[model samples]
Target: MADLQDDPDTALIAVGGLDDPGPSPDKAPKTRPESGAQTLEQARELLAAHPIADGYSGVAQALRESVLYDLEAGEGLLETDIPRLRDGGVGAQFWSLHVPLELTGDRAVAASLEQLDLVRSLVESWPEGLRLALGADDLADARNCGRIACVLGPVAGPALGDSLGTLRAYYALGVRSVTIAGTRWTQRTGLTPFGHQVVREMNRLGMLVDLSGCTPETMRRTLVVTNAPAVISHHPTPVPDDVLRQLRANGGVCMVACTESSIREAADRLDHVRTTAGPQSTALTGAYDTGTPHAPGLGDVSCFPRLISELLTRGWSEPDIAALTWSNVARVLRDADFVARATKSRRPPSVARLLPPLDA
Candidate 1:
C-alpha cells in the first residue's frame, strides 16, 4: 500500500453526520431559522437584501440551500443533493447516524445502528443512478462517473454499543471509521473506565479511533494509546495544545470540524498542529448546517464563498483545501480493503501525503 500520509495529490474531507435527520428532519421546512441551509426563495431574498459576509454563516447557508433547491428537493435530504454539492465542490461527506438522546432512550448506539440500517436500506433501494459507497474506490468511481461518493460513519460515538464486539460488528458491516464519543461518555467506548480498552480494541480491529466528541482527558488518552492513525472526525482544529502534542506523538490524524467555529479558528488549530506535526496535517469542514447558525445576525447564506475564498487568500492552498475537502478522507477510507471492495474501484490510486495532481 502507498504511504497515505505522504501522498501529495489526494486528501480526504470527512463530513460528519448524514445519518439522523436534523433535530426536526420531519418538521415542515421554513424560510429562516427553520432550515440550516437556505431555500431558493431565501437565497434569492438574501442576495437581494444585502451584501454577503466574509464569515461562515452567510456563504455556507447560501451554498447549502442553493445546492439543495437547485439539485435536490423531492429526492429527500440524503439523496442526490449532497453528492451534487460535493461534485459542485463541497467534498466527501460522512453520513452520520445521529440519534437525539431524548428520542433514543439514551440508547445512542442502538439508535445509531438502526439509523445505519436505514441508510443501508436507502442505498440498497437507490434508483439506478444512486448508490452508497463504503471506501475510497467507491468515491473514486462516483467521482469518475460524475457521481458523489459518501462514507457511512457516525458524528458521535455513543451510537456504538459498549462492547468491542459491537464495534467489531460495525467494522464488519463496512463501517470503516467512527468518532469515539459524541458529546458525553457512554457505557461502551468513551470517557469512562473502559476508554482505554475501547481504544485498544479499535486499534486491534483497524477501525479509526475518532476523538471528535471526547473530553480533553479522553482525547489525550486516546491519542497517546492508539496504534493506528486515529481521527477527530468533526472537531475544531489546532486541537487543545496537549491534544496536538499527543496526536503528533501517536502519529494519528486530526480532521478539522467546520461547524460553528470559523475557518480562521480551524486554520489556527491546523497551523498549530502543523507547526508540530509539519505540513502533513489535514482537517475537515464541519458539514452540520452551520450555514444558518443560532446566533443573531450570523444566519445569512451569502457569506460562504467569500469566507472560504478568503481562507485561500490567507495561506490555505487548493491542495490543502482538497485534503480537507476530499483527498485526506479518501485516503482514510481507501486504507480499508473492505470499504475499497465494497465501493468497487472508485477509490483514488494510492499516494503519499496529499498533493494536487492525480491520474484520476
Candidate 2:
C-alpha cells in the first residue's frame, strides 16, 4: 500500500462528513492518469449520472475498535467516511457486520447483532448521507434522495448457529447477506445437507448467499442449490476463473476488490474479471476500512472516478462501465427479490438444525 498522505486526491481534495465537514473538494484540480484527460472526464460524467453500487465494506470493524474515530467527523484514521463516499459516487454500499471467525455459537450471533447495531447507528446518525436499504426498492429510494444506501450483512455464517429461526430473525432485522463459512471452509468440499437447507431458506427469504471466502467446490455446490443469485463479495484472494464463469451462469456478480496496494493492480483485477467472467458479471468493491485500502488512486472512497478512468483506458465501453458501476448489481438484487417471491409459493420456512450442534 502506497502512502496516500502525499497524494493530491486525498491531501488536496477536501473530504469530511456532517458536523465536522471539510471544504468541498468538488472543485479541486483533478489528477490525470495515463488514461488521458478526455477519458477521465468521461469517467466523472458516468459516475455522476449512475454511482457505483459497492458490494462490501468493513466500517463496522473500524467503529468497533474506535471510540475516538467518527465517520461523521471523517477522521484521518479510516479509509471510508460519509464525505469520501459522497465524493466516491457510491450510491449503494453493503456494510459488513463483522463477527470474528473465532467467535462461534451464541457468542457469534450476539457479536453479529452488536455489529449490526453499530452499523444502524452509523447510518441513523447521518440521515442526510446514509439510508438503510432493505431491498432493491430501498436502494433506489436512497439514491433518489442523495443518500448512500447501506446494505447490512454478517461476514461470518456462524452467526446463525445453524438455527433456521435465527436466520429468519436476521432477515427480519434487515440482514440481506451472510458470508458462507465453517471449520471445513478451507477444505475443497461441497455444502452439507443442512447447508443446502440454509441455501433454500436464504432463497425463500431473499437473503444473498455471499461466497467471498468459500472454497471453489463449496461455491459450486451452493450454486447448485441456490435459486436466488449469489455474490462473491470482496475477499483478499482473487476468485478462480472457473468460479467467475459459474457465477455468470448463475446470474451472480463477482465483486472485484480494490484493496490492493496500488490503483493499477486494482484496475487490473477488475479488468481480469471482465475478461474472465464477461462484463455483466463484474462489479466493484473497495473492502474499505478493512485495513487494506492503500492506493493513492483509491486512497479512500472518493477516488472511484480514478478507477473508472483506468478502466476506460483499458478499452471498456461506456455502457459496459455503466453496467459494471450500477445496472448489473441492481439486476442481481431485483432477481433475488423476484426469486424469493416465487420460491415462497413452493417452499416454507425450513426447520433444519445442526443435528448435534457445533457448540457442543
Candidate 3:
C-alpha cells in the first residue's frame, strides 16, 4: 500500500469533537476554583460574558487556512458559515458519533444511533466542496475532486458503550478511528487500569487507536500493549520530553501542532526528540494551543507553519517533515481499509469496507 507522505504544509491537524464550535471566545476560563459550584458559576459567567462566534470569522478562517486541518467529530460541524474551515484551506475532516458515558444506558445505544443520523443529515446538507470521508480512497477521492473529505471518529472509548461489539458496529457504520479518552480516564482499555480489554479488542478489530487526550501513564501503557501503530493526533510534548521515542518505539508517530505558546515547547520537545531519537525521526504540527488554558484560537492553527518552515531551514528534509505531518497519520489510516486495504481482509460482511463516499 502507498503511504500518505507527511507534509506539514498539507497536514491534517485534528481539531475539536462533534460539538466543538472551533476556537470560541466562549471557551470556559482556563482556571477554575476548587469548589465545584463556584467553578460552574464561573463558567456560566464566562459563557455569558463572551459568546463564541457560531461559525467562521476572518480570524478563524485565516487560522483554518494556516494548517491543513481536520475537525474531529466531537466539536460537531462548523456550521455552514465556516466553509473556509471545510474548503478554504483546511482539507479533510472526521465526524464523530461521540456520546459521553453519562449519556449511555438502555437508551444510550438508541441515542447514539440518533446522533449518527444527525451527522448524516448534516453531511447531506454540505455543499459540493465539502464531503463526508470514510477511508483513504474517500480522502483521495475528495482531494482529487477539490473537496474536503470527512471521516468518522470519536474522543472517548467508553462512548462505544463499553462493548467491542459496539466498536465493531460503529466501524461498520463508518467510524474508522477512536481515541481512548480526554483529560479524564474512562472504562476504555489503554486509558486506565480498566482499559486493557478494550485496547486488545481495538487492535484485533483494526480500528485506528488515538491516544491524544490520555494521561502520560495511560499513553505509555497503551503504547506498550497495542500491536498496531497508533496516532498521537493532537497534544504536544512538555519541553525536553521525547514523545517520538514513545511513538517510534512502538512503530507509531506524532503530529505536533504548535500554537504561539506551545511553539516554544514544541520546539523544545523537537530538540529533545532530536537529541534522544536522533535527527531523523518523524514529527508534525498539531492543534493551535497558544498557551491558553482552553484550546480554541484560529491563530493557533497558523502558528505551526512558521515553526515547520524554520525546521526546514535548520536542515530537516521534506520527507522527514512529511512523515511527521502526513505519512505517519497515513500509516494509521492505512490500518483502516479506507486508506489501505486490510491484510487479513475477511471481516464479517457488515464490517467489510465500512467507509463509503458520502457524495456517492
User: Pick by lDDT: which candidate is best?
Assistant: 2
Best-matching candidate per TM-score: 2
TM-score of 2: 0.86
Worst 10 residues of 3 by lDDT: 50-59
Give lDDT per model, in order.
0.46, 0.76, 0.46
Writing each residue's lDDT as its tens digit, candidate 3 over 3-96 gives 2322212322221111111222123333435654553344333322221111101222222333333332213223322333422234454444
Give candidates' CA RMSD values in order: 14.5, 11.9, 15.2
lDDT of 2: 0.76
**Over 4 Å off, model 2:** 1-35, 183-187, 357-359
Candidate 2 local lDDT, 294-339, one digit each (tens): 6777777888988898877766666677668877777777777777
TM-score per model over all chains: 0.60, 0.86, 0.59
Task: Select the stronger candidate by TM-score from 1 and 2.
Answer: 2
Superposed model 1: Cα runs more than 4 Å off: 1-71, 74-80, 83-88, 103-106, 125-130, 182-193, 236-238, 260-277, 290-307, 334-360
Off by over 4 Å in 3: 1-83, 86-89, 96-115, 182-194, 236-243, 259-267, 270-307, 336-360
Model 3 TM:
0.59
